[model samples]
Target: MREWINLPELGMIGLRAKIDTGASTSCLHASDIQPFQRDGEDWVRFTAHLGTLVQRRHRCEAPLVTVKNIKSSTGHVQSRYVIRTDMTLGDRMWPVEFTLTCRKTMRYRVLLGSKALVTGQLVVNPALTYVQDKPVLLDISGAP
Candidate 1:
């Protein structure tokens, strides 16, 4: 079902989400992403470039897993890096892969695709917001 989502790793405090079945891999808005290191492991940090105003920026971090050549929504081939992060959409909380890219032209900074919402517990209702009354928090204190 359609539900609310908060990407705490990306500092998304409040946002309504629509569960999309038409998409394969999920996508998120990201830019100025510079891959770096901490404690000798591979990692990357970026800013979620959500608005036209450059002054407003939110920091996002993710551990670099692997980079792959994938196709875009418009059927163009593009290589993108995959990063794992916790996602809280309603009462459900889990880790998901999000393709980092510039989504300045999109309406939402994030879009939950089929891979993230398929094969299990959700039944999306497009006519409604699919509200879930629960406290959503990131379990990042022990995250690697």
Candidate 2:
């Protein structure tokens, strides 16, 4: 299922997503990823590129969740940085963990994997696209 989602905590909205039931973990497209410490806790900062034709870039920072080795569909395994953040789909909101990686070649910047679906109790119709309304962007001062 393809849908629009929101990362309110990240101040991102109306991001297109591929809700992949085959994927075990969700992922976000990111670049210039840098790890740093904040108040003695691990954190990560990166640039999240949005849109396909008219691209928009947003700088985001989140607390480090963990590093995990994920096997891609192309049979490549890589250690990726993970972060937990609130994701909004439809009218539901919940915390979802996402692996940050370079997905410039992908059609979607957000990949909603099986874990998110199960947690969100989402049932994909496969034939459906944009089943949920385009999420409203938060009126945040620094939102892009």
Winner by TM-score: 2
Residue 82 displacement in candidate 2 (angstroms): 0.0
lDDT of 1 at 78: 83
lDDT of 1 by residue, 35-123 (tens): 89888988888886543344357887779878767777689998777787778766567887878877777666677888887733567
Expressed as tens digits, the lDDT of each residue in 1-144 for candidate 2 is: 799899989989889999899999999999999999999999999999999888999999999999999998899999999999999999899999999999999888899999999999988898879988887654558463
TM-score of 1: 0.78
Q: What is the lDDT of residue 13 in candidate 1?
A: 49
Assess the local accuracy of residue 138 in candidate 1 as a C-alpha lDDT between 0 and 100.
40
